[model samples]
Target: MQIINARLRHQAALHSLTMVDGRFTAIQAQSGPLAPQSGQYDAQGLLACAPFIEPHIHLDAALTAGEPNWNQSGTLFEGIERWAERKPLLSEADIRRRVHETLELLIGQGVQHVRTHADISDPSLVGLKTLCALRDELKEKIHLQVVAFPQEGLLSYEGGLALMEEAIEVGADVIGGIPHFEYTRELGVASMQQVIALAVKHDKLVDVHCDETDDGQSRFLEVLAYETLKAGLGPRVTASHTTAMHSYDNAYCSKLFRLLKRADLNFIACPTESIHLQGRFDSYPKRRGVTRVKELDKAGLNVCLGQDSIFDPWYSLGNGKLLRTLDFGLHICQMMGHQDFSRALDFITDHSARTLQIADYGIAVGNPGNLILLDGEDDYSVLRRQGDVRLSVRQGQIIAQRPAAPLLTPPWLSA
Candidate 1:
């Protein structure tokens, strides 16, 4: 397969791409032109970018809103209670059905690589098992990475550590923890040690839901950083939803930022979920429930944005669109400034690819033949208009394509 007469964003001239055996074999820009093969796309001067990466998500429990009951309180704790009520009734068949549907939705939105957390706190391990199967079944279409997430606290839940280890044995790609939900400070520290040890034992990546509370004293992020430094897992470790960092004192945060940079830890902020869940206890003059995205980036740490939940217990509204997530992130973080807005685009594409540790994951020659075409002329234009993906191609094959919709005008508006 060859794509000719295409203009990449940074390139000086139009180029041609040849994909063979699912890898880009050649890219010719200013040299000799290559003839098009049976399949060819002119691109029509549209911008080409790397496929979107969904670094953090929960596939096992997605699209299950109001199953047993709705979250009347709209609080994180209430959502947890609702999920607990619904977990007992989850079957392999039910999980596979929803997981497949969710993957299709993501694909249609131009997502080719995804890292989903599966809850292993339940003794059944039904969700983890179901996603493991689905991961293999959908390998050709999408790359699904599973994390053995202890949704319930490790020490608080009965046999939680054993279940987590069992999930790893049954083929989980990453090890996950939620320290803020533990019973006590001692238990939280112990749980971090347990998560790091398990990752070492299994030689897998670490991604923890660390310090998700709004309390200014929530300091689990420091513990996670220390453990990452001790284990020597520099960039392979990820800290998702460190929302408490937003409330921390600036004097403390200034010092903490240096340590995070030293540890080279990756950060993921779910702006939509954080803004909704945090600030629940605040009165007037509320604080934004997101981590210091701009601060972290300024300190040269890898930071990305994640769409944590989609129509799940935690969040009941999501269309599985990464652009929507980016939109919320820019507004909440106050990153709408000129240069900052351009970098905000990286929060979804490049920064996320770094968190996932995807190899050769870009629009380059010799990389995997996976990319997307947007309905805008440039990067900032795409973000400004909240552009939709016009074409989603994987392995040199068009998996999903959308025709442009005609604008609708009313008679009354014609005046």
Candidate 2:
């Protein structure tokens, strides 16, 4: 397969790419009219780059909004309660249907890599088993990483610890915990220690829902970072949705930043959900309820964006597009400067690939032929318009493609 007239990222001239046996074979500057043949594609000078990656998402509970009741309170706690009310209704067919639909939405938008959390708080382990099966079943279409996530606290909920262990035994790629959701601070600290120990014992990665609360005293992130440093798991550990850091004082955060940098923690910030689910308890001048993205980026830490939920109880809206999430995150983080816009695609592509540990994930000669062509010429234009994906290719096979929407203007209405 050949892709001609492709405007690769960070390149000035148009280029051509050749793929053979699911691997990129050649990439060079286009010198002549290399017309695409039967098994080739013509990008037509559209911006081409590696496919997008969803670093954090909840596929198990996707497309389950307003099941028994809606979250009228608009708070994170109420969302949890609503999800609990709907947990018993989960079955293999239900989960499979919803997850497939959700993945289809994602695949249409050029997402070829995803990391999803399967709730292990229930005794059935239905969610975990189904996601594990899907991970293997759909390995050819997309790379799926399953996390054994304890939505309810390991120490606070009955048999939660054993259930998590069972999930790992069944086949979970990563170990996950919600430390801040525990009953007490001590329990939260203990949960982090247990999560780290289990991950090390199983030789798996760690992704904790750390400090995802509005309380200023929710200090579980500190314990998580400390444990990550001690275990020497640095980049292998991820801290997702540290919204409580928004409420932390400058003095403590100053000291905490040092520890986070030393630990080399990877962070996932769900901007759309955080802005929606957080600050509901405030009266006036509410907080943003988002992590310190700018500070973290400036500090040279790895931070990426995620679409945490899609029509789930926690967030009631989504279409499985990482660019939408990146747009919202850039706005919320006040990253609208020219330089920021130039580097904006990193949030959804390179940074996320690093978070998921995707090896050889770039537009290079020796890499897999997984790339997408958007309807814009550059990062700034693509993000500014929330551009459409013109073409999507996976392993040298065209998976999805769409023409750019045309605009018509009457002569009388022309400016």
lDDT per residue (tens digit) for residues 21-138 in model 1: 8888898784534455577876665667789889999999898989899888889999999999999889999998898899889999889989999999888899999999989998
How high is the CA lDDT of each candidate model? 0.87, 0.92
Which prediction has the highest TM-score against the true structure?
2
> Residue by residue across 1-415, what tens digits does model 2's lDDT show?
9988888777778898999989899999977556777867778888898999999999999999899999887789999999999999999999999999999999999999999999999999999999999999999899999999999888899998999889999999999999888988888999999999998999999899988989899998999999999999999999999999999999999999999999998999999999988888888999999999999999999999999999989999998888999999999999889999988899999988888888999999889999999877789888988977878899999888888788989989997
> What residue pairs clash in candidate 2, if any at all?
none
Task: Give the runs in model 2 whose Cα sits over 4 Å from its true position.
Answer: 31-38, 410-415
User: What TM-scores do the predictions have?
Assistant: 0.96, 0.97
TM-score, model 2 to reference: 0.97
Q: Ten consecutive residues with minimal summed lDDT in candidate 1? A: 30-39
lDDT of 1: 0.87
